[model samples]
Target: MSGPPAAPVSGLRALPAPDDGWKMLLRKEVLRFWRVAFQTIAAPVLTAVLYLLIFGHVLEGRVQVYPGVGYVAFLVPGLVMMSVLQNAFANSASSLVQSKIMGNLVFQLLTPLSSWNWFVAYVGAAVARGLLVGLGVYLVTLLYAPPRAAAPLWVLAFALLGAGMMAVLGLLAGLWADKFDQMAMFQNFIVMPMTFLAGVFYSIHTLPGIWQALSHLNPFFYMIDGFRHGFFGASDVSPWLSLAVAGGSFALLSALALHLLKTGYKLRN
Candidate 1:
């Protein structure tokens, strides 16, 4: 009472409370993968390199998909996109499903974190991982077959959009899956098939007319095709169409993921 309560004496000045919940979640997701760099980062890079070696040697001079481009050169962009897509999908899907199974997801809900924050955090982390893996594959592949870019901007755009699209799809897969088995089923049955069929190893133009049309129906094809165009300046479909498909797919999946989060589809109750 002597001096107006002496300004609330304390041992140390109180630190400002953290307000950016999304940033914390994003950081956590990033660190989660970074902590296991050997598994999450190095393993994929190694797998990609192996693909390059095995496929490059086998198809180097045999397959001439792009006009003047060697098969190995054509393969590099596809490998890069494949790594980006798979890793991006895996990052968000595994994180969410694992959190749900381990019963720690409820803790996140209890925080002031909003659904939008959740979306940003999960998708952003997935994109980061996907891009890193893609970059690793690209850099490593250059050693064996150095492919020059015709349109680097298109390469970057398709890479980002493709990764983002897969990330959003992963969010949906995570919410719908209750167990690890279901997640595995989703990956093996849906993701793996689509990716492999998306023309990672060959071009759609080499297929029959019916097959070529069907291949165009697969959104992953556009991503890979568009990405290849960036390198060779040619593709099965127009670059603009590829951009539209990839961009549109991302928007649609993002909306669905957001809806799931807002309604607490699987996370709550």
Candidate 2:
């Protein structure tokens, strides 16, 4: 005697594929920022514009990082890349911390999604927001002084790699931080200081010998330097070197973030 007949496959709804999990999470994360574009998107663009106007006006004639490139023109790419890195970091870091504080992260934990899904979804959303803000800054700054992209490919490459690296770093920060102040400390003391020192407003070559060497040690320097190279086709270091440093930093951070996610560090607690 057989048990009750098996349910008809056609009558039952199919479960979503594994890939769908990440996709749905990605969509949610993306919407989270897009819905608050006024704050997440517009505010950053305006801040970048203010930087351009203030610095470009004061230093336009006095400071020239690259020959034949005006100071305002030289400043545009740096500002754009800076916006990209900061916002990318903010997106994932804030999302994770907020979810944890509001007690919604458990909902995600209850899903069948793996650690990789969380990383991809969070990082992907970050990259989206970063690129969008970067694009906005670039466009608005163009109104001040148009920076040429002699190697547009380099601009695209470094933007993607830099944004990805920062996103992963932000994810790591998020996983480690139990509260908002910790995240703020990470950003304020670490991310913000590094970005400001990364040749955003001046060339490393102009620095004294010791400072120049110190600048070279900063990974954020490579990102801004390489991105500026795309504009002027000139840089303090070879773009190849910048690419290696940025790429390697990204890989290392990604591994650490994945390991933390797998262990559910601070997340499961």
**Judged by lDDT, which candidate is best?**
2
Per-candidate Cα lDDT values, in order, are 0.89, 0.91
lDDT of 1 at 64: 96
Q: Model 2, poorest ten-residue lDDT window? A: 8-17
Instruction: Indicate which candidate wins on TM-score.
Output: 2
Q: Give the per-residue lDDT of model 1 (tens digit) for 1-269.
A: 36565563212112322488789999999999999999999999999999889998987889998678888888899999999999999999999999999999978876767678888899999999999999999988889887689999999999999999999999899999998899999999999899989999999888999999889889999999999899889998899999999999999999888777777787764
Model 2 agreement with the true structure over 148-190: per-residue lDDT tens digits: 8899999999999999999999998898888999999999999
**TM-score against native, each model:** 0.92, 0.93
Give me the overall lDDT of model 2.
0.91
Question: Which parts of model 2 have CA positions greater than 4 angstroms off?
Answer: 1-19
Model 2 TM-score, all chains together:
0.93
